[model samples]
Target: MVELTKQANPGGLGPTRVLLHRPPALTSPFMLPTTGESEQAATGERGRARAALLPQRVFKKPWPCEAAFIVNILVFVYGASIGWMSPMTLLLQSDKSPVGRPLSDAEISWIASIAYLTCVPADFLIAYLSDKIGRKNSLFLLSLTSVCCWAIKLCSYEVWAFVLARALMGIVMGGAYVTCPLYTKDISEDSVRGLLGSLVILFHTTGNLFSYIIGDLLSFRIVLWICLTIAIFHLILCIIIPESPSFLIKQGKEDKAVKILAWLRCRRETDSLVQREIEIIKKEQKTDENSSNFALKAILKDKILFRAFKIAIIVALAREVCGAIPVLNFAGDIFATASKGTNFVLTPNQQAMMLGLIQVTGSMLGSSVVEKAGRKALLAVTALISGISMCALASWFVAKSYGVDAASWLPLATLCICIFCDSSGLQPVSVIITSEIFSYKYRGTVMGTAMAAAAVCAFIQMFFFKNLATSIGLHVSFYFFGAVCMFAALYTILVIPETKLRSLEEVHQDLRTKKEKREEKALKEVSV
Candidate 1:
C-alpha cells in the first residue's frame, strides 16, 4: 500500500525537527485516488501512532541496545588478546617460561605481526561468507575461530603453535570488522544505530583493559583459560538470537523477517509503520537484484557511488595511518619519559591502564554525541582538534632539543588528547559513516575493499614507523601526521554531507544534487 503525504515546508526548520513529511501524495496522476482511501489512510496512521506508544507502556527498556551489547562482548576478548601479548611477551622471555626456552626477538615479531598479514586476505573471504551464509552464522564461525585461537594457546607452547594461534586470530579480526558492523546496523533501529554501533569499539577497548589487569594478576595458564572461556561463551550465546531481518528478507522468508523486525522494535507485526519499514527493505532488495549484473564495473562507473567510495577509503586509511596504533604501541615509553622527574608520573603498566580507561570513556562519549551533533560535525571537530594537538606535541619535542626546558607533562597531556579524539570521534565515526552511505547491494563489498586497504596501510605504518623515525626524526614523523589530519579536516568541510537520520535514498539524492551544483558553478565561472 503506497501512501503519499505532503512534503515538508521548505526554507524553515523542517528537516531537523521531524521524520514524517507530506510529499506529493501520488507517484503519478494516472493513479487516481479511490473512494474511502482517505479514511483508510487516516485510520492506519493512528494505528502506527498507537503502536509507537506500546514500547513506552510495556517494554520500557532498549532491547536492541542490550542485544547488540551482548553480541559485541566478543570484541572485548579480541581486545584482551591484543593486550595479552604485551605482558605475555615479557613473561615468555624469562627462564621460568612454559616453553623452557626464551623466545628470540625475531620469533616475537612474527607472533605480533602475523595476524595482520592473514587479515588482508581474510577480509574478502569473510565478507563473502557473511553475504552467503548470513551474519549470525558468520559470527558463530568467528567465535569458533576465536575458540581455536585460545585453545591452541592453552594446549601448546611451541613457537609454531603460537604463530598458528595468532594466524587464526586474523580470521576473527576480519570478521569482527566486517560482519559485526553490518549485523549491528541491520538489527538496530535508526534512532539508536550510532549508539549500538559504537559498542563494538567500546567492548574491544574494555577487553584490552581486562587483559592488562588480568594478565598482570593471574598466571599465564589461567589467563589463557579465561580467554578461552569468553570465546565459548559468545558461541553459545549467539546461537539463541534471531537471524538479521535484512538477511531473512533476502532469503524470501518475509514472514520471519516481519516477526524478527517486530520483536526487535517492540511493535506488532500488523502495525503500519512496521509494515512500511518491511516494504522499504523488500524494495531495497529488489533494487539490489536488478542492479546485480556487472556490479563491480558499474560501481566504478557510477560517479556518486565512486565518490562515496573514495571518501570511505580515504577516511579509513586516515583512521589507521594517523599514528593512533603506533602511539598506543609505544605508550609506555612515552609515558615513561613524561613521568621523569614528576611526582604524579605513572609506570608503564599503569599508563596502559590509564589509556585503556580513556579509550572506553571516549567511546562512551562518542555514542552519546553521534546522534545529537550529527556525523559530519563530530568528524570535522575531532579532526581539526587532533591536527592542532599533533602540531603542538611536535613543537614541544622540537623545543627540548635547543637547551630548552618544556614542562615534563606536556607530552603526556598531548598524547592523551590525541587518544581521546581518536576513540571518541574519528575511529567509530569512519565506520558508521561508511556503513550508512551505501545501500546493502554494495555495502559488504565496499566495506571489505576499504578494510583491506586499511589493513595494508596499518601494516606499513606498524612495520616502518620506527624505521622512519630513525631515518628522519620522530618529531618530523609527527609533523607528517599533523599535516594529514589538517587535510582530512578540510575534506570533511568541503565534501561531506550531513547524513543524520536520513534514509539511504535521501542521502544519495543529496550527494547527487551537490555534484550537479558543483558542475554548474564550474561552468558559470568558465563562461564569466
Candidate 2:
C-alpha cells in the first residue's frame, strides 16, 4: 500500500510530496495478498529484469574543472604581477623613465622587496577571511587588490605610487596562495584533485609568460591597461561561481550544500554517490565540532596532525628557498655573466622571456602527469634534480673564478634545469600534498601558517640575495640552495607518504607514528 506524506525537500525549493510504502501487519485482514497485488508484483519483476539488460549510463561532470579554472584566473593575474617587475624595473630605471627620473638603487630595492614583506600579514588575513566569509567571497574580495594595483599604476608615474601598487599586489599574492588551494581542494573529487591542484602552478606560470611577452613587446601604458582589464574580468567571473559546498555545510546549510554538491558533481541530489559523499562531509565536520580545543591547539595536541603540519612547513620552506626566486628575479645579471666570453648573445628582455617559456612548459608537463606520477615520487625526483643542477651551476661559477675553463653553456643549462624542475614538480606537488593531508577544520590555519613562513623566507632571499651573492660569492648562495633541495629530497623519501587519490583520513593514518598505530590496534581489539 502507498501512503501520501509531506517531507522537507533537500533542495530547499519547498515542501515535497512523497509516496511511502506501508506493508500491512500479519494480524490484519489486509495482510492477505490480492490477485491485483500479485499481478502488480509480477509486472514489477518483469520490469526489473528488462532494466537489468540495458547498459548502465555514466556522467562525467565538467563543473568542477570549470569552477577551478575560473577561480584560478586570479592566480594567473597574481603571476603576471610578479613577472611584471622583471621588465618594468628595466623601464623604470632607463632614460625614458615615466617618472621623469630614474629610480635610485635604494628605491628600486625597496619596490622589489616590499611585496614579499606585505605577503606575510596578508597570508593570515586571508585565512580568517576564507573561513568567515566563505572561500568564494574571500577570493572575490582579495581580487580587488589586483584591480587596485593596476589602477594605481595607471593613475600616476610617481615612485610612491609604484611602491603602493606593488604593496597591494603583494596582498593579492599572499591571499591567492592561501585561498586558491583551499577552494580547489574543496571543490575537486579525490580522483582529479591532484590535477586540479596542479593547475595553481600551471596558471601561475602561464601568467608569467603572458606578462613577459606583453611587457617585452608592448608600450608601458598599454601593458598596464591590459593587466587592469584582466583583473576586472576576473572580478566579474568571481561573482558567478558557486561557493564551496564544504563551506556551506559548515554554515548549517545542508540543504543548499546538497544542491551545490550535486550541481558540482553533475548528479541527482538523491544519487547514492552524492548521498555517500554528503555523509562523509558531515562525519568529518561532526568530528571537528565535537573537539573542545581550538584548531591550532587541536593540531598541536594530535600527534598525526602535528606531524602532517611539520611536513607541510618543511616542503613549503624548501620550495621557497630552493633558489628559483632569486634566479628568476636576477636572471638578466646571471645571463650576462654566463654569456661573457661566449658567442651566446641575447638581450635581457629576451633572456627573461626564455625563462618564462621554460617555466610554463615545465608547469604544463607537471600538471599532465601529476596524478599518474603521484605527489611523493614527483616531489622527491624534482627536488633531487634541482639540487644536482644547482650544485653544477655552483661548480661552474667556481671554475670560472679559477684559471680553469668550463663550457659556456654549463651555467645556463643548469639554471634552466633548476627552473624547470621547480615548476614541474617541487612547487606544485608541495601545494597538492599540503592540501591533501589536512582536514577541513585545520586546513586554513595550517596553510596560512606555512605560507606566511614561506613569504618570510622569500622576503629574506629578495632583500639580501644580491648582496650575499656579491659579498661572498654567487657560488656560495647556489651551494646553500642546493643543500636545502637535497635535504628536502631526503626528507620526502624517508618521511612523506603518497597522498595521490587518498582521503584526508587515509593520509593521516599513514602519518601516524608506529606507537600510535600499535595503540590504535590494541584499542580496536579491546573493543572487539
Candidate 3:
C-alpha cells in the first residue's frame, strides 16, 4: 500500500497541486520539544529535534541507506502474483493451476482465502520478531521462505503442494510487505515519507501486473520461475542495506544509527549535524515514550485513531470488492461467457496484464504529485471518477445484451479508468494514509490490520466473483462495485482529513483531540 515517493512517480508524474513536502526548517520562530527516546520513542523524538537542528532548514534528501526499491519491485512483481491469479484460475479450471492438481474455482478460492487469513495474525508476529531481532535479518529469513515456496511449486505441481506453497508464500510475503515501510520510515528523512510510503504499493502494483501477465496472461510456469530467480537475487541487496535507525537507537547504539544515516544518504554528512539531530530526537522521544500505547487496546480507545483505522481497513476491504480483482483476474472467462457463446477471439488475460502494467506506470506518475495534489483532494476526485466509469461500463454491457450498440472502446475505457482509480488514488492512498494517520507506536499494528483487510477481501471477492457475476449479471456486478466506490468517496470527503505537508505528530494530535472531545461529550451527557 505504501508508495516510495521517488519510485511512486517512476520519474515523478502526478498532480502538481497537493505536493507533499516537509516545510523548510524555521528561521526566527525557533522551538524545540523537551523529551528523550525513553519518552516518545525514536520516531517521535526525531520529529522534534530535526526541526531544531535545522535553523535554516536544509531539506534532507531521501534515504541514504542501501534501499531495496528495485528489489522490492522484483519481490512484489514475482512473489505476490503467485498468489494473485494463476492459482485461483487453476482451481476454476477443475484442475490444478499450470502445474498443480485441478479444483473448481470455488475450492481453489477457499484455498487462497485461507492463505490471506493467515496474513492477518502473521503481520504483527512478523513485526514483533523483526523489531526484536533486526529488519534486514527478518527480510532475509522471509526471502528464503519465498525461494523455497517457488522451488517446491516447481517440483511438486500437486494440489496439496500448490496450496502449501501458496500458504508459505503468503507468510514470507507478509514479512516483506509489513516490515518494508517501517524499515523505510526508520531510515529515511521526513521530507519524503509520502514518497516512501507510496512505494510500497508501486511495487505491489508492478507485482500484480506481473502476475496478470506471467501467470494469467502468458503462463504460470514462466512467471513462477521468474519470481523464484528474482527472490534469490534480492537477497544480495538486503545484505548491503543498513538496519533501521530507530532499531539501533533502541539498542543504545546511537553512533551506529548515525553512521548508517550518513551511509543511507550516500554522502559524508558532518558529525556535528548528526550529533545535533540525535540530541533533538532524544528530547522529543521522551514525549511519545511516556504513555505510548501501541497495543490494540490503545488503538480501540483512541476513537479518531480508531476511526482512521476503521476507514483504512474498510476501504482496503471495499476496494477489493470493487470487482477489480474479479474483472482483472477472470475477465477472459467472463468475456467468453458474456459473448453469448461466441469464441471471443481477444485475449482477456493478456489485456488485463497489460492494463496492470499500465497502471503501475500511472502510479509511478501519481506518487510524484502526491506532494502537490493534496492527499484528500486527489483521493476524492479519483474515487468519484472511477466509480462513475465502472457504473457506465456495467450499463453498457447490459444494454449491449439487449441489442443496444455498446462500442468496443467502452470496455477498454472502463478498465483503464479502474486502473487510474486504483493505481493513482486507491492503492497509494490506502497505504500512505494508513501510515500517516496512525501514531508511530500504533502505525505498524494498524497498517497490518488494514492491509489484512485487502488480503481478506481480495480472497473473498476473487473466489466468489464468478459466481456472483453469474447470479447478479455482469451489469449489476459492476454496479455493486460502483456503489462501494461511491460510499468510499463520501466517507473520504466527510471524515478523512488531508494529511499532506503535515507533521506526523500534528496529525496524531488531531486524532487525540477528536477522541478527547468525543469523551467529553459523552461525560457531559451521562446522568450517573
Give the count of colliding residue pairs in each prediction. 6, 0, 48
TM-score of 1: 0.85
Ranking by TM-score: 2, 1, 3
**Can you tell me which runs of candidate 2 are displaced by over 4 Å?**
1-60
lDDT of 2 by residue, 430-463 (tens): 9989888887888888899999999999988888
Per-residue lDDT of 308 in model 2 = 95
lDDT, candidate 1, 1-528, per-residue tens: 222333345586456433342212333321222222223454576545433433211222445776687678678778888889877887888897888899888888899888888888988888888778898998899888999999999889999999999999887887788888888888888887877877787888788888888888899999999999989999997887678888888888998888777667655566576688899888877877756454456678888788888888988887786667878887776565445556867766777878888888988899899999888898888888888888888887788766477887778777888888888878888888888888766777778888888888877887888777767766787788888888888888888777778888777766777569798789999999
- Rank ordering of all candidates by lDDT, starting from the highest: 2, 1, 3
lDDT of each: 0.78, 0.86, 0.65
Error of 1 at 458 (Å): 1.2
| Candidate 2, poorest ten consecutive residues by summed lDDT | 29-38
- The TM-score leader among the candidates is 2
Q: Tell me the tens digit of each residue's lDDT in model 3 across 1-528.
A: 111222134356774332232333323221211222222332465455443333222334334323747336434833364435543464346543454345665556555655676676677777777657777777777777777877887787666776877777778656666777767666555556667667776777777766665555445566668777877787666665677666677678887767666445432335465665566455544554665445577667756557777867876765666666776667677556555534444565556666677678868876787767877877787788878988998888888888885665677668678877777877777667776665445656776776676777777776677777778788888888899888888878887777886765566555555667788679989955
